[model samples]
Target: MAKEAKKIKKVVLAYSGGLDTSVMIHWLKANYEDCEVIAVTGNVGQEAELVGLEEKALNTGASKLYIEDLQEEFVEDFIFPTLKAGAKYEKDYLLGTSFARPVIGKRLVEIALAEGADAICHGCTGKGNDQVRFELAIKAFAPNMTIIAPWRTWEIKSREDAIAYAEKYEIPLKITRETNYSKDGNLWHLSHEGLDLESPTNEPKYDQILEMGVSPENAPDVATEITLSFEKGIPVALNGEKMASVALVKALNKIGGANGIGIIDIVENRLVGMKSRGVYETPGGTILYFAHQALETLCLDKETQHYKELIGIKFAELVYNGLWFTPLRAALSAFVDETQKTVTGEVKLKLYKGNLTKVSLSSPYSLYSEEFASFDEDDVYDQKDAEGFIQLFGLPITVQALMAQKGEA
Candidate 1:
C-alpha cells in the first residue's frame, strides 16, 4: 500500500460533486502525499446537481475539474442499446445506475491518459456495486492504472463519519446528514437507498423519497395519449414530432412523471453477495421499455423474441456487474442490432395514473396475419394439420404417460 501510494503522483477522480466526492478531493491530497487531484464529472442529466460543480471541485483542493456532457451519449450509446437488448436486472430494475458507471469510467480513463495521471479515484464504497463497476471498467481501459478507493481504506465508517470529515476539511456540503437516504441520478433514472429503506419491511416514505416525478397517488385523473416512433429500434419521435435521443427521454420524463408512470421498489440481489432494497424512479425509461416491447412483438419472430428474452437476462447481469467494455457485451450488442433491423414502427400509448397501456402498434415488418389466424378456417391453414402438429409436439409427454400405464399393467 505504501509503495503504490508513493508511486501515484497524480490521480484523476470520478468526482460527482456530491458530499462524498467533496470530501474525497481533500482526503486524497491529505493521504496520498501531495497527490495532484483532477476531478472528472459526467453530466448525465443530473439536472440541478451539475450546478457550480466545477467551482466546487476547484475549491475543494482539486488541481482542475473536467465536466463532460454525457447526456446524449448516455442515451444514444448506453440506454438505447440496453433497451434494444431488453435487459432488465432482476426482472424489475432498468439497470439505471448499473450502465451509467461504464461511460463515466471510460471518460475517467481517457482523462487520466491525456493528463498522464498514475491513478484514478472514485468515491464509491467497497460494499456497493458501483465500486466493482468503476474498477472493472478502469481495468478494461487501463490495466495498470492505480485505483484509489478511499472509502475502503479511510477510517470513515459511515455517512456520519464522512460528515465529520467534511466538517474538518471545511468542505461545502449541500447533502444533509439528517436524510439517511443515498441517491444516485442520471438522465436514465433516479435510485434511492439507505435510511428506512435499509429495512425491507418498511414502506418507503414516497413523499420524502420521490424526486424525479410525483407519486402515483398524486397523478392526475385524466389519461394522456402519446405516439412514439422508432427507427431501427431507436426512439426518434414523441407525439409524432421528431426529437433527438436526449430530447425524447426528457419529453417522456415530463409526460410519464405527470402520469406517475414509473416507480419500482425491489429487494435486489447485489453482485457483492447481499440483498439490498432499491427504490428506482425511471419514468421515461419505463414507458420506453414497454413501448419498445410492443414494437418487437410485431417485428421479431416468435423464436427470435423468445431467444432474445433469455439474452436480456444475461445482458442485465453483465451490465450490473460492470462488464460493459468486454467482448461478450460487444457481441451481444451486435446480435441485438441485427434483431432490430425490422423493429422500426410507431406505437400509441395511453398513460393514466401510473398505468401505461399500449393502444396500438404498427410496424412495416409486422408478422401478424389475421387471415392465417382466423377461427373460420382460412386457406393458409387446415384445422386437421393442427391435430397432427399437436400430437407430434406432445409425443414426449404421451410416451411418458403410456410407459407409466404399462408399468401399472
Candidate 2:
C-alpha cells in the first residue's frame, strides 16, 4: 500500500481580499488536502476594500477570518515615527507601502501563533519588495514558523492565470482586465501600478489612472491655506480642529486631493534588485510631511537638525528595505523620538496645484530670535563686538600668514 500523505492542519494567510489572495484561499485548501485556512486581514486603511472581507474569506474556504483594525497603531507607531524622522526614499517616495508592511506582517505572526497554525502564507509575488518585507518580518517575529509564498510555489504565473484559476473554482473577485490596475490603498496613501504605468515612457492618463487624488489641471484656482498642529512630532490637529488620527488624515486627504497636493511619480529600486515606476497619491501624507518639517525647523537646534538629516536617509533606506524589526531601526527610532520632544508647534501651509508650501511656523521651543538675526543695530548686541569676534574667528588664518612673514623676516 502507498504511504498516506501528511495533512496540513491549519494555515494562517495574510489576506488582502485581492484577486491573488482571494484565489490563494481556495488553492491552499485544495493543494494541502483540505487544510483549515485562517484568513487575517490587517486594516491599515483600505476603506471599502475591506467591506465584505470576512464574508469573502469564509466563502473562499477560510474556516475563520480575523479582520484587525490597525489604523491607529499604524499611524501612531509606524507612520508618525517615519514622518518625524523625515524619512523619504530617494527624496520623493515617502515609503508608504514599505512602512505599512512590518505592522501587518508582525500581526500575521501573532495570529498564526494564537491559532496554532503550522505555516503562514502571503500573496506577495516573487519579484516584489513585499515578499521580502513580509518574509523578513516573519523571520524577525516568528523565526520558527513555516512560510508559504503561493506566488513563488504555485503554478500560477500571471494575473490572467490567477483570474482563470479563480473562475474555475467559482471564487468571487472584483478585478477585471479592463479595470485592472494593481492598487494598494491604506490610510496614509494609495499606490497605483500594473497598467500603462508598467512602461517608464508611457504618460499616465490623468482621468483613467488616478483614484486617491484629483488632477492638478482640475484643481481650484484659489490657493488653500491649512494650519497643522503638532505635539511631540505627531500631528494633533488640522486647522485648529482636534480630531482623531484616522479622521484627521481622511479630512486632509479630501482637502489636499482637491488642490492636487500629493502626487509622486518615481522610478524606485525594489528590494528584488529591479527598478519599477510607480505613481503614488499621498495627499494627507504630503501635508503632514511639510507641516512636520516646518515645525522641526523651529524646534530643533542647528546641529540636531543637521544630524537628523543624515539619520533620515538611513531611516528611509531601512524602512524601504524591510528592516523595520532590526535593532538599528529601533535605535534610530529612539533617536528620532528624542528629537521630537520639542517638535511641538503649528505650521501654516499653502496648497495649490500639487504643491505644499510652508507659509509660516511657530513653536514655544523656537531658537529663532528676531532681534539677534536683525540687520539693524540693537542694544542687545554692540556693533563693536563683531571686530573682536571676527579677530578670534580668523586666528588660524592669521597664524598661517604670520608664519609666512616670519620666514621672510
Candidate 3:
C-alpha cells in the first residue's frame, strides 16, 4: 500500500511461516508488479515450528525458500554474550524475542543480496517492538535496501482481519480464533501476547496457554535438585555431565519446566512507547541467570559486580531497542567479557513449585576469605583497623554535623 516512485523487482522476506509472514508472501506478489518473493527462514531454535516449513513457504507463493540453521550461532554469539552481560529487559522479560531479531535480519539481508532482490520484507507489526528490531538490523546491514513491512502498510488492522485475508486465499493456518495468541519461541524462551493477555486485570489462562511447563500447583510435590557448572560465565555442564551449550539449555528447559520454575506475566513498556502485556516462559534461562549471578558472587569483586549491574540495565535497553549492532553494545560486550574472566564455578540449586533456592556454590577465584570474616579473632584482619577506616569513611558526615553546630552557636 506504500506509494513508491520505482517498481521493486524482487523481495526477500524474513519468513517464519507464521500467520503474518504466511499472508505476506501472497500479499507482496499480488501488490507489486511482477515482484518475485523469496523466503528465508532462520532456524533459531524454533524447534517444531520449522517442520514442513519449506513446503509451506513454496505453497504460499514464494519462488524459493531457504532455511538457515542458526541455532548454534544464536546460542553462542547472541545468547551467551547477553547472558554474560547480565541483561534483562524490564528486570524480568529475559529478552526472549529481542535478540533473535538481529540474527534473523542479518540473514534476510544476506539472502536478499545473494538473490539480487531489491527489498527485504518482514511481518512485524507497527505497534510492536519487532518492527524496530527488524528494520534497524536491515538498516545496519543494507542501508539502501527497500524494506517492506506489510503490517505497517497493509489494510488489515487486526489479527481477525489477517485471518479473514488468509481464509480468502485459502492459506493454511495453525491457529484458530480462540487459539490466536501471538507467540514467539526459541532456545531460550517462549512468549505469549495479544487476546486475553491484553487486559491487565485478566489472570492468564495458564492451564490453556502454557506449553513449556506446568503451573506451580501442578508441579511435583518433591523438589528437583541440579548442579550447573560454568566456565567463564557460560554454562558448560548440567548435573556434572558436560554437554554442548545447545543441549545443556534444552536439558535444563525440560528439568526446570517440570518443576514449574520460570513463568512471569508482566505488563512491559515497549520501545514503541506503548504498554503491552505478555506471559513469558523461560525455565532454562531463569535457572542460568540465577546460577550465573550466584557464581559471580564467588568470583567478581565488589566494585565490578555492582558496576556490572548498572551495565546490565543499559545493555538490556540497547537490546530491547534493537541497537545490538551499534558501537555502544559492542563496547559493553567487551567490558562484560572482561568481567566474566574468572566467573568459572559450580552452583547447586533446588527448584520447587516455581521457586529457585540456592543450595551451594563454589569457585577457585572466590574472594571470600573466612580468615578475615570470622567472628573470632584472626590475624589476617586487625580489629583495630576498622576504627580508622570508619572515621575516614564518615568524614563528610562528621564535617556536616560540625557545620550545623557552628551555625547554632
Best by lDDT: 3
Clash count for each candidate, listed in order shown? 0, 0, 0
Q: Considering only N, C-alpha and C atoms within 3 Å, which residue pairs clash in candidate 3? A: none
> Per-residue lDDT tens digits of candidate 3, residues 1-409?
4356146889998999989999999999889877889999999888899999999999999999999988888889899999998999889989989999999999889888888888898899899999999999999989999988888878999999999999999999999999999999998899999898999999999999989999899999999999999999999999999999899989989998998978999999999898999999999999999999999998999999999999999999999999999999999999999999999989999999999999999998888888878999877888888899999999999999999999999
When sorted by lDDT, best at the front, the candidate numbers are 3, 1, 2
Q: Looking at model 1, report the run of 10 residues with the lowest lDDT sum.
A: 172-181
RMSD of each: 1.2, 2.9, 1.3
lDDT of 2 by residue, 96-176 (tens): 899899999999999998988888999999999998999899999899888889898789999989889988989998988
Minimum summed lDDT over a 10-residue window in model 3 is located at 1-10
What is the Cα-based TM-score of model 3?
0.98
lDDT string for model 1 (1-409, tens) is 6667788889999988787899988888887887899999888999788898889889999999888988888888899999999999989899999999998898899999999999998999888999999999999989988888889988898998888988987898987777857899987899999978999999988888888888889999889999999999999999889999999898899889888888988999999999899799999999999999999999999999999999999999999999999999999999999999999999999999899998999988899988987888678887878899999999999999999999999
Report model 2's TM-score to 2 decimal places.
Answer: 0.93
Q: For each candidate, what TM-score against the reference? A: 0.97, 0.93, 0.98
lDDT (CA) for every model shown? 0.91, 0.89, 0.92
